[model samples]
Target chain A: MVHFLKHNYQDKDYFFLWDVESGSLHNMDSVAFLCAKKRYDKTLSPNEEIEYKKISSKDKDEINAFFNQMEESGSLNSPPRVTYFKKNPDIVKALCLNICHDCNMRCAYCFAKDGSYNTAKEYMTFEVAKKAVDFLIENSGERKNLEIDFFGGEPLLNLDVIKKTVEYAKKAAAARGKVFHFTTTTNCALLDKETADYLNREMVNIVLSLDGRKATHERVRKCLDKTVKYEDLLKKAVYIKEIRGDKSYYVRGTFTVKNLDFSKDIIALNDAGFDQISIEPVVLEESSPLAIRKEHIDEINKEYERFANIYLDRRKTSKWFNFFHFMVDLDFGPCVNKRLTGCGAGTEYLSVSPSGEIYPCHQFVGMEDFIIGDVFIGIKRPEIRKKFSEICVLTKEKCQNCFAKYYCGGGCIANAHKFGEGMDAIYELSCHMTKKRLELSLAIAGIEKLYSINA
Target chain B: HIVTLFKSSLDKNHKTGCGECQSQSCKIHKKM
Candidate 1:
């Protein structure tokens, strides 16, 4: 019941104990770490047991009393009971509009299957885009700000539609006493001065795709014309960074087995003047050549530590940018709704395909089974909505036992449905990576806090 | 034996009422 994970930074002599149930973090000595592990009824490793034996009886009793006090304070074993927002359905707060399911590039690991989502290549019409915006406004309930993400094979492919959609959402929201926050994810293949200017002025955030280094990026992401150069794309992205000024943007990359040394890619993006960077591992079936497999988890885990060190190194400079996964603000994390139920996919958020059909999220856009409703009907399938609404750490049997349960919110439902047993099941591979990243995040936060305190 | 670095609970925080947080990282992930 004392759910906690003992973690330490690489080559650091100190250890940290994270009380998962309560989100309480502590800096502890090695003996206390091993002692807490044993007292929690967890079996210690041979080396840990050896160290455990070295603890004096008095010290052991003191640590036990401390843990007992924490337990008595309801911070150790008690997991909060979460009530699903089913009785009163959660108001939709965000939507990912698949503006155009057609891409100019051929990326091997693209989940959208070259932006078509394995469907007929299409673009969302102005009418459909307008309806999607209206759907968001109608369902947003008391929420003032609604989020609409311009997504696609490459959102900029339907640049005109994106602009029109933004215009429509802005006008519609203002009239209805609601505000819309716009975001777009692009390959930067079709980005130009005019489009960048338009996006900079309209979008609150933009995600630019660059798969790390040139070799790694080119290995998977290729232009249809074959004449486009990575340098050209990089130039345009850098231009956006400059012109966008203070508005948020990040260069996101996907690393496959072909690039296990993905930390170098984060460095590459940083070196290229991109401060806010995120390089994520590709999610592919193991049979695929580019897939990150069981064999590669160890290497990837080590890469995470390597990236953590580099992240800390950058923290000492003005060049530091927020790494997506490593941005762990312990004092101010996600709200209770998000912490318990994860990203509100079906309930509080939905995805709109080019034709206006609604799915649970962007990852489920083309999958027919996931289509809960269309923009016209507005969530017709209450049963499907109920299923999504029920998803949470408490509902997931595996997550209930996981130390990282609250942090990950039972992992991605899309990944669970695709790779695991079902929506309630956890994706083991992603779970492994999530735990590693969480560990590193805590270590980074602890190190920074200690450093600041010392200074 | 224990030096508490940071400790806070979801229930104790007043910001749990709304989704709006200045941290764009949360929004970016929510949108994703």
Candidate 2:
């Protein structure tokens, strides 16, 4: 019954380790385990909440046998009583600013009313951009690896700001004896020779947001001239890749349901010398312009799946950085299949918009309600961390109980809150997709590893 | 032997499901 001795471990502290059965389950704190050992002879019920007392050998064997069975099937014996993520510090990978809130092309599904179509010229001031930099410097001083991401109304609209921020960050990083990972998500509308040179020189990652082929891209991203920007975007895409000389530099892609059919586009990117692509389903929000149905998500997932297979098979992209890292559980070789499968949202790499408002990520920007803190004040004044802590404490319910919990951890906080589902909601379909995505990614990696001449 | 190919089996399955939800604009349904 006490095969793994918890006698030395503190009575109340939980242990997150593999058990004797080679299964991952949080078998209570030291006290509880000892208590279970004491009740060694009692009739055990895995679900029943009870205390301990010294018992017989037969009962001990029975209890141990039952626990092993549960572990074999990938289920948790009980809730997690300890949390490690709460104690560890986070490294700031990228801090994206809402530099240009006024894009030239009005995307059809944009949720913000103050968008290109509505003509809200809400550009970030140079001072606010400074604050974003300050936020990075101040909040992430402890870490050696850091990144500064430029976001948009078409961030190129505020090219001066992008240039200034990167330049400043480089100097500041040098001053502090740190480094920077400069990146951006742009519409490729402003991908000229000048910008391409600056990007390649600084090794800046240009994330082009084009859905797919000309027809597909034109369907949504439209300019004021009512012209489909597809042809222009494709032209720019070709130039950006050719000039960058490195496939990783030309990260042009799109977000939308229509883009699930990106095989042709994937082929194009592969052939054009620009590879390392990133793709995501157009995130559906309540305030979005279109009435997206479930069918769209299904189709998008399918499309993304097809695209993912092609890109991954060719080694054009690795899910480890962008999609899979967020999607899967590292140890599991798949996403933690539980309901709350996700990383430390507020706790890990945080987000700060142009207005000095702190959010969890760029995805959660613009939704004013999601703002957890403001720059003028600081993290101490905000309840964002507090709320996140409360959410993190809910591990045992949805996550610990489900088989996929460890692989997933917990999902995106925004998605959980958006669905009006508490963090404890039983396995979200995201759990399923996350697992599905990673399993495929690893499979691809294995196949590549097997046949690669380098290997 | 039952190990499923994520791209072919699971991912395609999820995409078809998401496509159905894509038309809804996420007001009533925002996520998978």
Candidate 3:
């Protein structure tokens, strides 16, 4: 009757007890964890009960109190409930506009069908871009703040469309009494002063891709001719820093089998004067050389630990750097409670391709099966929207029992499908890495709190 | 009551929002 999940880290068992009815998380120590595990599994052996009773009267009393509290809280007999969102297709608050089907650089791990979605290279026209913006604004329901992200092979390739869309979106949002926020993800290879200035003026949040060290970045993220140097990108990065200031930009990088010790890349990015750095793992086919193998997980775990320590050490001197992942609060169950899945993909959020095809998210843009609607028609597959809205940790059999379920939301749906797993399944490597990262983040957060208190 | 306990225990300055959520297109933002 006691629904809880257990995780073993560093040989210590930690349990998370969920109040199924109320969606609450209770951190439990090993003793209480074992007791609850037995209660939930109905496997309390005779010897185990005797051993539990003999764990000193004080400890026994504490465990009894914990049980009594759970019973009183009505969590003892409650079944786990899946979090569901009533799909309202009209309430779209976020739209990712794939402005360009062609990219300047040909990165090895370019997931957007190798950055062109395997189609003829083209750019989203002003008309299509404007229509996408209008669609977002019209369907945004009563929401005051709506977000439009300019995405593509390289959004900067179609800078004119971005500029025009922003101009139109601003007026449209103002007329409707709604605020609009624009964001863009760029490789920084083509970020000229004019583009940087324009992006700065518009206050567009920029995610700049710079894969740590020069060799690592060049190995995967290279020019079409494979002659682009890291310094060229670094110079542009510095220029964007000067224009956008530090707070408005993030230096995003990726790590793969090529760079397992990516903490060095984090340090490299930090040394390059980027205060906000995010290093991600390269998602590729399992057979791809860049795909993260199981053997690399241990080193990746160590890198996270090293990065956490470096992050803490930097904070002590008031460096004010933030590793994107370590910013989570372990005490908070999940990012959003409204949906059970990791993100609001097909429901609250949707992506529009350059030619006006609608997909669940950016990753599914060119995939035929995921096309949810078009710009002119709106969401055509309400059933698919409902399916995504219904996918939560509870729906994932593995996630329902995972200790990190609340933290990771059962991993990403697209990633699960990438590894030949179902939408409700999570990639095992991602799960392992996420759990390790969460553990490290928890440790760092604890130290950070102590340091703050002492300071 | 449980939500209150969880919230109070949380570091008030801690960011609970996922960075990938802002991207809208990225499902798993944090890669190891």
Candidate 4:
């Protein structure tokens, strides 16, 4: 499939085309864009006053020849092949330790059932956390650098486990000649100076949760404590920003149906002194009131477009910040295997529950059917690992015909299974948003490239 | 006119040699 988009940046018209299998980008002029679009859709007809309708027969043939040349160079219409599946034993590289299953806030759109994961509220003991580290090192297989994310209903609730886990992991990993890269996700509601200092000194990356503007954040992420308002949370987050200067972090927010104009939320984050930001669309059941429905896709797409323009304007100034979804690494994207298989949730990465029970990823923590094994015993179900190992674009029938298949890697399996029919089916809403984000990201990248060349 | 902006190394014929490599982690893959 030919994946291309027409965009207007600062009154400059441009077209961005993507080579699906090769993951390459080409910027096309209007003539080439029209010709390529027509090629992709044979019955496409231009309006009477349009430029394509006024093209000479000779010029049309020349455009066709150019397309043929591009096709011959394997830069257009080249489909991906189904390669051999590599299923190595004991190659897991990352673990998300859900240290606490209890949260301080009652976010209406929370997927973790208000941080309890649909179970009783609990905290991971130091022993379980220590075993999790040992489990990671024992099963890491020749991997030198390992990743451990202190995750949960708010990992700071179980502060002792996090501190002890980090200290133990460092000592154990040093003895085993393995390096640990630590990260954590927090709501910043319980962030104090002492913990903030400790996190700054220990963690490599921290994700601070704030839902953008005061009203928008207050609408969904309701703190249980009446006294702790949005301003209070923002103060704590800003303190982290002050202490953790230049360190990698993001102020992550979620937008529901209530806040379709989520661009304002992102801008609020940038204005709040947070540079790296990611405001994601909330995934909820259709029955839920706050869930983003099929009809909301268009408005969300427009919001993204508006945000892209604002992002471009900010790029020219000193106040610019990075938006995670809009950022793409052209120099070296993910490897072909990774691009095909996606995040490696079940195989390469696993989530450890408070009790040391292991699931595929954080999303699958409480589901009994998805329980592969515990950290102490290691992955017991090879069949589940095999299932995720075979999860690639080629294996998923719905993804085979999609233009954005390679970019998203068939999307999150948990969402597909929860929202769609099964793991093989695509979540249509998420897929639509993904395509829009990819298009805008490519357009921004191309526009910047042109600017640099002209300058 | 058409300008090729960036072509990734993960083309159809690109070889990762994942099977022979001792370390399974790629820097870009780890970001995901």
Provide chain B TM-scores across all predictions: 0.26, 0.20, 0.16, 0.26
How well does candidate 4 score on lDDT at residue A279? 95
Of models 1 and 4, which has the larger TM-score?
4
Worst 10 residues of 2 chain B by lDDT: B19-28
Give the candidate order by descending DockQ: 4, 1, 3, 2
Tens digit per residue, CA lDDT, model 2, A1-455: 11222111112222222221122323344334543444432444453334333434565576556556544544323234223333123333346667766777777766444343233467777777777777677776455556666776677888887788777878877888667777776777777888867876775466777665567667777875455356777777767767766435544455554555656765655554544555444445644544334445566456545654555445544422233222322223321111222344564456666567777665567666667776666564346655564454244364544333334446666666654265435325455555445434443443333345335
Candidate 3's TM-score reads 0.80
Q: Ten residues in a row with the worst lDDT in model 4 chain A?
A: A81-90
TM-score of chain A of each: 0.94, 0.66, 0.83, 0.95
Instruction: Put down candidate 4 lDDT per residue, A53-132, tens digits, no spaces.
Output: 77778978997897787778777776664445444435787899999999999999899998999989989999999989
Tell me each candidate's TM-score. Answer: 0.93, 0.63, 0.80, 0.93
How well is each residue in A1-455 modelled by candidate 1, as lDDT tens digits?
A: 44444444556665777766567677777777788789775898898888888889999999989878877765555455453433124578889999998999999999999999989999999999999999888888877879998899888888888888888889999999878889999989888888899889998999999988899889999999777899999999999999878889999999899989998888889888998888888888778999998889999999898888888888789778779889787775766555765677787878999999999899888898888889987887877878887776677677666767768866788988987668877788998999899988888898888888779
Give every collision pair in model 1: none
Candidate 4: misplaced stretches above 4 Å?
Answer: A46-50, A81-89, B17-32
Clashing pairs in model 3, backbone N/Cα/C closer than 3 A: none
- Reference A-B contact fraction recovered by candidate 1: 0.44
Candidates 1 and 3 compared by TM-score, better number: 1
- The better-scoring model by TM-score among 2 and 4 is 4
Off by over 4 Å in 1: A1-10, A72-90, B19-32
i-RMS for every candidate:
5.2, 17.1, 10.0, 5.4
Q: Which ten residues in a row have the lowest lDDT in candidate 3 chain A?
A: A80-89
Candidate 4, residue A455: Cα displacement in angstroms equals 1.3
The true-structure Cα RMSD of candidate 3 reads 6.3
